[model samples]
Target chain A: MKRARIRWHILVFLTPAVLVYTAVMMFPLFNTLRLALYTRIDQERVFVGLDNFRTLFFDPIWADQFWNALGNNFWFFVIHMLVQNPIGIALAALLSHPRLRFAVLYRSAIFIPTILSFVIVGFAWKLILSPIWGIAPDMLDWIGLKSLYAPWLGKEEYALTTLALVSVWQFVGIPMMLIYAALITIPDEILEAGEVDGITGLSAFWKIKLPLILPSIGIISILTFVGNFNAFDLIYAAQGALAGPDYSTDILGTFMYRTFFGFQLQLGDPHMGSAIASGMFIVILIGVCIYLFGIQTRMRRYQM
Target chain B: MNKARANPYNTAAMHGALILYTLIALFPVFVIIINSFKDRRSIFREPLALPNSESFSLIGYETVFTQGDFFLYFQNSMIVTVASLFFVLLFGAMAAFALAEYRFKGNLLMGLYLALGIMIPIRIGTVAILDMMVATGLVNTLWALILVYTAQGLPLAIFILSEFMRQVSDDLKNAARIDGLSEYAIFLKLVLPLVRPAMATVAVFNMIPIWNDLWFPLILAPAEETKTLTLGSQVFIGQFVTDWNAVLSALSMAILPVLTLYVIFSRQLIRGITSGAVK
Candidate 1:
């Protein structure tokens, strides 16, 4: 057999991306995980061996904030999964209707928010929902539903949900577009087949189309899961790093931010921040693993 | 299709629902843009109304221009985003070409290693990244933002690009090889052009996030000189929160560029998404 020549060009092609990604992303991530197992004591870095994790999970003060943020993060994810995905799927279905008018205009318009920066979306909603100058109250009044209006972003009970909904408003286009893509790809023959079987219109969708798009939905669900757990910019932009209304809107991202770079009177603790990041990594990993091992394996991906 | 045509009432409801959601999506943005042009008082009084001659004022924009380094912030954002996009596309394409064209040992492992960052966010490593930045003196520089964004963008770019690259006709590349065209030549001259649409998809996907990212800019490069448009608007808006005119104008200013670009590229972007580039 002839000796195979070493493809130096392949290495040359791959080196830049690999080097940059490793140095900037992978190395930092592993270092962060390592940092989580260490702590600074008296200005000296010392290995604490999961003490930070213990503090984050078991210590009363740290545990309270940690759990609150985790719970809020889950709620954020839930809102997205429950409200955003369904609405997105519905809008996509509506848009995909063969006779739907102005479908292009509607999709483009609805997707406008998705392209805007979170700073823009966050502050835009903050103003629109402001108690004083906000038009939410006025709009409600015009509709004779003034009693339904409140400073939703200011009230503790409503803050996180309001932010989550705002986030949904910005990102619903994602699922919609993804699902829409999946919908349009469904062969006409299949729908015609469904119609022949008396599964037309809404019934057709519920029975035939929905099953085929379950894989797309699964992908969207996992994307939403990852996005929601890592969400920070909206809350930070709207409510500041405090994630206020007494931290009702805080999530793992903000919690990590605050701990990594202390806010107000609290001193920054990198160790605890890494610990939080690790916790988030675990949560996200668990979610992804469940999807991969538990859910994805069971879903049937239709070839068509 | 016939069922949809037969149900006129259903069609009406579908249009109605779509129109309603469309309004809901565009309303806040519309209000902000209009209000930004009006005097602060009109902004409060007729927040929903269009700007009339009597209500029109440029003071908000004037305030925004004078109070912050809006131009500098814009320049910084442009530099970072464009530079990051350039590196991401180039490096990502090169890497994708290798994986697609060359059958090598550990290729699967290499693919998986590169793809790891797709599901796991780059933000989790901010602690050590910041530390490394500080150590290397890249903190508070555009370089820091660019490097971070390049890393952030590469995984998805490589993944998408490789998928497209695989579909490029092997016959063309083999013929080119027979012609004594170097591998690099084939990649640069042939493969890159073939994958332009996917490159656009990757670019569009990464562009918005990089331009709009507030976290890394806030943490890694929060200095006055290195402030991105997103961070600048954020800090500017935070300070001028009580000033509705300035805030609205600042926001509108922040929004106008992105909105304009989006309008221009909206078709391409939507097409990119629905084209299954991501799937």
Candidate 2:
């Protein structure tokens, strides 16, 4: 009887969170997946199991857009992995130096962009790179690299990559901070041991600190993967829902938003929108699973 | 430590790289803010120049204030963000406390269930979420955004708070229990105060995303009265794109509040993140 009374309090504590999370998050997510498996016909819901999936994959019109978006999404992820993570790691490594002057100032300033809304970053970059505004051209001329100036955000070949770089600029702070945190936790004794063994300076970083921080790197990688795939606001704010320069910048998020919400001439299609979202879900799940099972489990966490 | 003394060149190079990156990060924001104070022609003629008495103008800010429902949007954003933060911290702490303090059946399962949102982006359910909101007549309401944000924030809140709750000394809680304090009182008086730093960390983490979120606000609360600062700024800038002064000022207005808050709380925010509350 006493134990039963005790258990009641547990339910009391858990109820509100469980109720809210389920109603708003889990239920809607599962419902979306369910919606994807069905389609509307004659203003009534109709079961169309895997037909949406088949149309998305095999049908030429849908297939082209889906593949384009998916490919662009992968490139977006690749840029973050290759560009953002390395720069972030490098910045963290530099900032973590014990005698570095103005380390806090540098860290704080670099992270300033991260806290601003995507709207600000997107529009700010847009204005800076605007051909009419002449900032980019002027800056290039100042540096005597005027020949390199182009309206990158307006060019089909360069729009996606340019936006990806902008995103990297805003977000590199995350990995930098995370890695810096990890780097600071390393026992000074370990580095001293490496120093005593004639492994100091860059060599000490490479041979000792680098290996110790691999787990942090892995965490940063997965975060980049998840964040990149789900990214919408930057592209939407900068490129519009059409994700143009001829849809070159259309990642899954923008693609799904356009498909669901409708834009210009296109009418909304919730079923197909859910299908795209479901596709994103699978992609993110695969990436996360690979990290969790394939990478995280294998990486040996040091006791220190 | 001696590496600094031994390698002056290396130290200089590190500082050089960091300084260059910091400048790059701040350049655009600085440009926007400065030009917002300048007249339109001068903004284009000398975008990099600081606003002097000759260039200074408040025309753009006047336009933003008069033309758009900017204050309403700010209020809506504040309401949604603050209300959501309250529920997320309260309910999340309660749930986290239950998991940390009790060894109940399905505890791990419940914890994992709550944690699913941490890895899975909640935006996947936009289609259904929109439909449900419409069904419940919540579309275009601040409550819709608040509820969605609360759900979105809870998983991470529980995850971080649970870690902190586990570190709260058990003896204190037991002694409180012996004094005839109920579980709720023990939670309110004992555990919650101990986990305040973690709560602040969770608040800092959730606050930015909620404040700056465009997706939910755009989708659920796009009505004129219900728009958030982010969506409002986006729409305002879109309409006034060619009006350079107004555009720059609108962008500046949006940036200033978040910038000020970030500057003030940056120490606590950095400490929270570096304290490994996330990992």
Candidate 3:
């Protein structure tokens, strides 16, 4: 009886969180994959096996959008990897320097945008870049570069890239903070030894600090990958679910949303939407699996 | 250390790079807040300049309040965020305690299962979540949002709280046990207090995402009564796209509360991250 009573405490403590998470999170995730395998016929869900998958892949209508969104998503991830991570690393390196004046102030300032809602960041950037307002143009004109100013958000050629950069601007602080934490964790004795060996400044960063923080960087990269692929709020906020200017910025998240919820002309298709979501799940799963099996193992070995 | 102080040229260059990056970081926010306070003409005419008495006006704010139910939206946001944070912290702490303090069956499996949500976003489950909400008649209700967000926040909260909970002193717990305190009492009185800072850190980490989330609010509960500040602002700005005054004002309204919270809690937030709590 006492053993049973003691066990009840664990159950009492664990039940609420586990129940809620399973009901709302895990069950739904699996259910979505199940839903993807079935399609509606005369308002009833009928198991269609891989029919939906075939339609999604071979049907030009769906294939074009799927591939386009997938490609755009890749580009978005690439931009963050290339631009945001490097910039974040540089800022973190600089800020982590011992005796840097006003480090806290700079960190707070740089991180402010990260805390702002996607709605605010999106609209603020949209307005600033609007050609009619001439704010971006005027700022450019000050440096005699007004000719370079264009309605980047309104053009198919530049909309996705433009939005990607905006997202990078907002979220660079995360990598900076994470990498900063990693940098500070390095022992002072090791750095002192490096200094004794004449490794300081830029070379010191490349030779010593960079290698030690590789695990953190790997984590950040996976985070960036998951975040970019899962991204929708920024695009939806900035350009609507259509991800407009000819749907140049539509990624998997937006595509899934539009498919599930339906936009102006499109009817909501739960089955197909689930398929796209499952597609996204697979893509993310592949990325994560690769990281887990490939990158994480190698990184652990190097760290050891 | 000597290398840093010995070179004035290097110091100047470092300062210059930092200042340049800082400007790039802050310029947009500065432009938005400053322009939100200016009259329509000056907002466009002098977007770069700070408002003087000649150009300053509350017309934009007046329009925002009159046209939108911003106060109600703020209240909704407050309720949802606070309620979600409470549940996340409480439930997360309990679960963390169970995992960290006990040698239980399926503990590792459960931990892995919960941590999966951290990597695989809850957004992917929207189709079924919405379907379930609709089936249960929870769609278009704030409860839908609150529930989903609680679920969304639990994984990270559990992970971080458990890490902190593991560090709690076994000696103190044993002493409490010997003093005839119940396990529940020990957790509430001792372990809970010990992990308070971590709980604060978890709350801070989760707060911004919950408060600033546009997707779930848009998907789950976009009804007027259920609209959060982020969604309300998004919808309002979308409608008033051409109305620069209203648009800018609405955007500022969204920014101010979050910025205020961030400024207030930034020390805890920064310390929480830099203290290796997350790592």
Candidate 4:
């Protein structure tokens, strides 16, 4: 009887969370994956195994859009990996300096943008970059670079890159804070030891601090990959559901949203939407598996 | 280690770099908020300048208040955010306590299953989620948003809270056990107080995304009464795309509450991150 009471208590504690989570998150995720394997025909939901996948790959109309969005998504991830992470590291390094004045002020100021919604970030950037307003142009003119100004967000050549840079501007704080946290955890004795051996200032950071924080950098990179791949709100808010300027800014997130919901003319197709979602799931799964098995395992051995 | 070796020139350069980036981070927000107070012509002509008596106008605010149901949107957002956060904390804490305090069967597996949500984006299940919501008659209801946000917020909350719970000094728990305190009481009266700071950290972490989320709100609850400030502003701005004043005002209205809350809680927020709570 006493053991039964203890077991009941445990169940009581776990039940609400488990039930809610299972019903809302886990079940829906798996169901969506299952839905990917089936299609509908003439008002009847039919189980078609991998036919949708084949259509997505071989069907020219679907293939073109999928490949385009996938390519753009990869480019988005690349910009974040290349530009966002390095700048984040540089800022974190600079801010983590021992004698830096107003460090907290700088950290807070830099992080303020991160908490704002993508709607705000997207619209704010849209207005600033609008050539009609001349804010960006006028500012550039002050630096004798007025000729450099163009309607970047409207042009097919620069639209995605512009949006990516704006995203970087908004989110650079996350990696900075994460890396700063890791940088501060390095033991002072390690830095002192390096100092005693003629490592100081720049070399102290390069030779001592950077290596210790590599694991944190790895974690941040994986996070960036996951976040970049799943990103939708910014593009949707800035360029609308069409990811406009002829879909130059379309990524997997927007593509899936459009396919799932159906834009003005296109009919909503859940089966194809699920297929695209499943494709995203596979790509993300591959990226995560590579990180876990490939990067983290090697980093673990190096840590000791 | 002397003051001279600190390199005054290097310090100046570092400050310059930080100051420049800080401007880049804050300047856009600054421009929007200031321009919201200006008349249309001035908004374009003196976009970079601060508002003066001649330039200042309440027309934008008047338009936002008149043309949009901002108050209802704000209340809707508040209800959804607060309700979801309450459940996320209560349920997340209970689950975290159970996972941390017990060594029962499937403990590790359960933990790993919960942790999977951390890496995977919940948005991938949009199609099924919408279908389930529609089937359950939850579509276009705040409950749909509340339920979804709770699920979205729980995994991270449990992960962080459980990690903190494991450090709650076994001696205290043991003494409470010896004192004839029931397990639930021990959790409520003792453990809850102990992990309150971690809970606060979790709350802050969960609160921003829940409040700012546009995807779920746009998908699950786009009804007039159910519109969140984020979605409402998105639609409002999209409709009034040519109205510079209303657009800037709408953007500023969205920016203010979040920015104000951020400023108030920024100390705790930064402490949470820098204290290695996140890492």
- DockQ of each model vs. true complex: 0.89, 0.89, 0.86, 0.84
- Give the per-residue lDDT of model 1 (tens digit) for B212-266: 9999999999999999999999999999889989999999999988988898888
| Model 3 chain A lowest lDDT segment of ten | A1-10
Find the candidate with the highest DockQ and give its number.
Answer: 2
Error of 3 at A290 (Å): 1.1
Answer with 2 or 4, whichever has the higher DockQ. 2
Question: Please, what are the lDDT tens digits per residue for candidate 3 over residues A244-292?
Answer: 9898999999999999899999999999999999999999999999999
Per-residue lDDT for A93 in model 2?
92
List model 2 lDDT by residue over A1-304, tens digit each: 1455456889999999999999999999999999999998989999999999999988999999999999999999999999999999999999998878899999999999999999999999999999989999999999899999899999999999999999999999999999999999999999988888888878988999999999999999999999999999999999999999999999999999999999899999999999999999999999999999999999988888
Model 2, range B5-29, lDDT digits (tens) per residue? Answer: 4587887888889889999999999
lDDT of 2: 0.94
CAPRI-style docking class of model 3 based on DockQ: high
Assess each prediction's global lDDT (C-alpha) against the native: 0.94, 0.94, 0.92, 0.92
Off by over 4 Å in 3: A300-304, B3-5
TM-score of chain B of 3: 0.97
For all predicted structures, in order, the TM-scores are 0.98, 0.99, 0.98, 0.98
